[model samples]
Target: MVNPVRKDGTLDPALSIKNRFIDISPPKVVGLSNGVKAIEWKDGKVIMLDQSRLPLEVKYIECTDYHIIAEGIKKLWIRGAPAIGIAAAMGIALGAQDITAKNYREFIKGIETIFDVMLSTRPTAVNIKWAVERIKRLLKERRGESVNRLKELLIEEAKKIHEEDIEVNKAIGRWGSQFIKDGDTVLTHCNAGCLATGGYGTATAPIFVAIEQGKKIQVIADETRPV
Candidate 1:
């Protein structure tokens, strides 16, 4: 004879909630949901999801042309300043993938369309415009080079843009941790770190660094809401 619900004699529901609601038992650091997927590059196509509708409806759209990707960036389906810059670079790469231009003028025209579209994605982020403009300049300056080589360069540069974000986060953490003592409370406003950037996060980096250093800290996550 045993009581089913009181097997452990405790009223806490943490066990039941974790077992029922969570997909992974112990949780994985790089779960499928958060991990990066391999970029599927067809002969001439851009297949990607509009991330703005995410945490709501998981929708993936194919960009037959560069215009769609530009709109996705501007509309914020794919945001975050650094992320947007990376996306813009990708957009240029995608735009150039199928180019069969016969002369320098025609080639420059195609890339320029993409450049203008990408710059319009988000007006506020200086980095976004800067990235697109840099690519545009590279293409313009090297008009005599092979178009295929230029596209390869674009892809490599885009990867760098995304990779640097990780370094940025780690550096922020190292520098900011010096301010925190052994035991202190931290208050974070909005999601300014990992989610906002790429990996390490911006405002949230120091807190993580302090925690790793064995500093005692309490985090007050501000719930942004209209009062």
Candidate 2:
């Protein structure tokens, strides 16, 4: 049976506690509890949870084409600061996967086009620019490498961005949890939690961390309403 994927694409803690893994070919990024990831890069391609189908069906989107990633961002199939940023980085990597460039100069030229296109998908998100520029900088520093090596480096770097986001969010969770003590009730605005972040989320990170820390905390999201 398909488990319901939350707005954050996390699995039901009750059902997914025993298993969570990724399938490379068909590209399934199923989650375990809070371990869910909204987007992932695999086999030089992008795999994402179809968030638009939430509360009804759980589906995944495997994009071998970078343009599809861009379209996902534009259409909110992938929404969230860190997530969209991760998507851009992965999309750039996927876009570069098929480039038949013979030399560094030609390869970089194509990367520049991809970099801009990914950024345009979500111009306001700082993370998108942060991620794209990081990739751009990686290329600039690795100009001495061959095109094939550069392509590989881009994929690895994109994965690094994805990993880094999880860590960063965890760090935030640890630090923020301090403010949330046992029996505290926290009120937050829209998309401040896992709903719009890489993993643990921004504002919601503390609550999850607090709970893990053995705190009894209640949360009220100002933006959430019954359908």
Largest TM-score belongs to which candidate? 2
- Judge candidate 1 at residue 122 and give its lDDT: 77
Model 1 over residues 1-227: C-alpha lDDT tens digits?
A: 23335557774464443333212121222211354321223455555556666556767677777777788777766656665666677778877877777777777777777777777767777877878877777777777877677777776666676667667877888899999887566677864655455555677778777766777666665553321
Q: Which ranges in model 1 have alpha carbons more than 4 Å from their true place? A: 1-51, 54-65, 223-227
Clashing pairs in 2: none
Off by over 4 Å in 2: 1-35, 225-227
lDDT (0 to 1) per candidate: 0.64, 0.76
- lDDT by residue (147-226, candidate 2, tens digit) is 98998898999889888877888888899999887777777776655535566677677767777677766665556542
Would you list the clashing residue pairs of candidate 1?
52-77, 193-201, 193-202, 194-201
Indicate the worst ten consecutive residues by lDDT in candidate 2.
Answer: 23-32
Quickly count the clashes in candidate 2: 0
The top-ranked prediction according to lDDT is 2
